[model samples]
Target: MRSAAMRDEPRVTDAEARRIAFAAFVGTALEWYDYFLYGTAASIVFNRLYFVSGDPVVATLAAFASFAVGFVARPIGAVIFGHVGDRRGRRASLIITVTMIGVVTALIGLLPDFAAIGVAAPILLTLLRVFQGIAVGGEWGGAVTLAVEHAPPERRGRYAALPQVGSPIGTLLSSGAFALVSLLPADAFDSWGWRLPFLAAIPLLFVALYLRRRIEESPLFTELLQQQERSSSPVVEVLRRSFGRVLVGLSASLLGVGGFYLLTTFAISYGTETLHLPRSLMLGATLVAAVVEIAILLAFGRLAERWGPGNVCVVGGVASALVAFPVFWLIDTKNPALVVLAITAGVACLSVPYAVAGSLLTELFPPQLRYSGVSIAFNLGGVVSGFVPFAATAVLAASGKQSWSVALLLVGLSVLTALGGAIGERLRIEDDVSAA
Candidate 1:
């Protein structure tokens, strides 16, 4: 067993690093594909298809509320999976978490809707979401650690960034998938269109599992195993050692991910509700935003390689804060040109901070507690911030602030995100094995 103070030993080969990186990308992509498919269904179709309630609005909110339930479950899931990763191995945790997501998501597709089975339909869907959150809670830490620990010390930012970028890829795929499915006749869409996307997850998960099994465990994890340095209880150790960083991580994440949940998950409802925009127009904007996110993410990944992940995130924060007002302005105008530009800018800014963040956050702790730390911190952030859209919706319902409302309301959040990024950037925690 290695002690908390064991000296770092570098054993990562370039070939090994490349292999792990690909595995990280594929694994994360499939994991997210499963999750995003559900997010899409919940936001758009699930309320209509799954819920027995006649009130579409209530049903939609119920669906999203169930979505929020998953976020709430994230912390507990993180604790459980972190324990497994810490006590067992990252490879095992990775396979388990990813497979959990795939099976649960596919089950949602296979489930009968309200028309077929009544209340049981929505009940089954909610159950699937709970499973998904638990699976995803464990996902971020394992995937990020796999790539980050195997990366060259100097290139940790870029290596870690690869897995995180899969988010944009997943969002794009999910958005694009549903958009395509939406083209079916309204009758068809209500009946079977939604099931296609959900069932599609099966093959994707199969591919992810195949790639994941072939890859060896992270060298850093193996080192921890060899040294007997794994934590007995990662959650407890993290609470004891990193309580402050955990708080900071949660705060930083609120604006970044909260903003994300708002932009994507909430945007679907927002487009239909606030803007009275057609599904096609809003979807096109979403697709464009996804494409834009790819470039911004890759750029930040490169920037993190040069300036450290935190520093790159800081720059992203500053840009996001400054762009919030302009983004709102364009979104409000309903100009196709403006809408495209606005959504693009918003996603680009959000992607920058997020791209570097997964790595930066994971690197903050030591290898032994790394998986738990990252999972707990990130999912807890979700619990706090994941419900912003629903909260915003509630606020709007009460305030009746429809004139330039949502666009204006979300500006402060952008600034908050930027500040958190700036603070994180300044504190460049070294990735070397931390105190156990």
Candidate 2:
């Protein structure tokens, strides 16, 4: 069944590539579903049920801060999981991270509301969120490395992008779940409806674990083992040899990571509270946007193969900055269709940079240190991006609820990513020359 051109492809068989892609894509999707479900719950359920503040806005802010608390723990997770991933094997790290995320997420479902457990409710929720943060912080580097390292050199761009596709899939599943549950009568929804989505993580966890187990370890990592070239301390090694590139990678990722939460998480609060949009309408718009995002990400992933990932990402970064103001303008109109248009525009701009990020960043470090380098850079970026919802909310309050303030934040972030992408392009060239 192989094409004439594919017959000469190097390093990996088509069948093995397909298997690696499926395992990475599906496993990351399940983990992200668990992570994003918390964001959805933060906007709707957690503020009311866990925080229990006298003022609605105050409760919302507190809930968002709790969400940020998860990011605060990510670097720690990255170090712990990154070391394990680099030293032991990608398969073992994945097993631990996925299990941690699934268990924490399901426990969140079982947690009592403020009325039942009082202060203990919010405290326990924050702790569980921290565990979720650690698990996911460690999850991405291993997942992407497995896919990228298993791929043929020529197809690395496309294969690496396969894992990036997981974000939209996760968003779609989480938002779709919320949208369906948003249908219950207000009191019923407030009581137990939200828990259903969290509890649903159990089955997804099993499937993802099963898929991950069936896959082989990264061929590149296997080669490292055969050569007896594994780093004694990958975290330390990456920092020693590639710290600057790691910082550049984190900067490049800011727009995709932070701006996404700004649009989705902060936008949800803005839509419901300030614009008076129905929760269903907002969730529905996001659901549609998630679908739009998947298409855009897939298209961009393919485009990266032709255009070059850095060139494509540069285009995306600049475009995101340009579109920021108009997208917010559409949202301000409060029409459901316009809101969908606004979010779709945001996703369109963001997807290009995101689709190629795994491949682009993967090239920055040598294989022995790749897992650690990527993990540290990415989780640190998460630490920064993780605060977007909290910071955007404060900025909105300070600016008298003007959406432009948030739009401006997006513009600033997009510009940083563009500059970082340009720098990364230069670094990538240097890496290529050195490897050559």
Candidate 3:
């Protein structure tokens, strides 16, 4: 019933819709930049700096465990900020989330290493990661809701996908920053060069805040407010009424979140440590893959409008599954060109579903509960995804550093995503009929 009312809400001007999409893009990109910075650092620097252990493998695992810590806090952030978005407003929730992430990211930069402070160093780092997780848990849902709600119903696919581009943009920026710094002498790189990217978060935060401040509130959310139709407890309402949808949403979200870490974070670790490839080679591969992902996202956004977001996701998932083994095979060659091609192909294939996940997830719930619903489902998927790199790393180690085990993990995630897309398509069809 609420979906019907949302469809009837006045559409914003094209210029207004574009402006909102752009604003959402900027804020999301910055949030992801901060988030991905941590991931990249965990792979390249944190293990050595913070997670000092007798075994190199033990140190790497500990660093990734800290990386996973942020995922644990994501769902908590989702519930907290989801309530704020569904009640107070999307704008308010976004402002707070971005600020929290920026501050936490900058603090992570200044944090002392184990040599400087002992066990307390890692404990403090883990605490800051928790805050980062919380902030980002709220970020994606609100950004998508704000963009999609402001757009014409028929064009929501395009607008919704705009914010999704932030992932690759974030990947590109964070990886590019590290790639530049990785050029420093090994001792210098470890000492202070690594801190530069995290510290860069401070200025980027201000730019994001400025853009977010100027954007208009979501039109659909505004109507909910005027009608006094806001749910008193949106998180509970969503779960009680739409638990199944939430589950499907989580499935739909897995590849975009989990598959991403597999291709980038874990892959970087594998390439650098196991293959004895240069760190620059891994970082450069990631940068190239990110660029490819951005193009794929924009292209698939348009495709989602034509094919339906869910259907596009299904196709993407299938494609990712097909490419999974080949991606690993290429990386196993250990040739720089083949390795770059492997990462780019893997990232590009997975990006198709990721490109449309925002629109698909948005359509799964009504406007009144949209923020909470999307946040809970997506972040729940993130909770699982957070462990993906750690899991992939562990699997690789257990398999005697065989790349195929990690490839199989990607295949499994891809199939799950396909199933979610199929279910989501059925739900979307049912929704269209019900609205009619």
Best model per TM-score: 3
Model 1 ranges off by over 4 Å: 1-7, 52-56, 401-405, 426-436
State model 3's lDDT.
0.92
Top lDDT model:
3
lDDT of 1 by residue, 1-436 (tens): 2234334646687677877987888889878877877767776788677764767667767878888878888887899889988788888998898888888888888888888888888787788788888998898878887787788766767777788778778887888888999999999988888888788888988898899898787777777788777777888989998887776566566655777777777777766767777877777787898787777776787688787776666666667777766776776787777877887778788788788877677656667887888889888988866577677666656667452455555566665556656656554443232332
- What is the C-alpha lDDT profile of model 3 across 293-400, one tens digit per residue? 988999999888888889999999999999999999999999999999999999999999999999999989898899999999999999999999999989988999
| Clash counts for all predictions | 4, 0, 0
Residue 294 lDDT in candidate 3: 88
Which residue pairs collide, candidate 2? Answer: none
Higher-lDDT candidate among 1 and 2? Answer: 2
In candidate 3, stretches whose alpha carbon ends up further than 4 angstroms from where it belongs are: none
Distance from true position, residue 204, model 2, in Å?
1.0
In angstroms, what RMSD does candidate 3 have relative to the true structure? 0.9
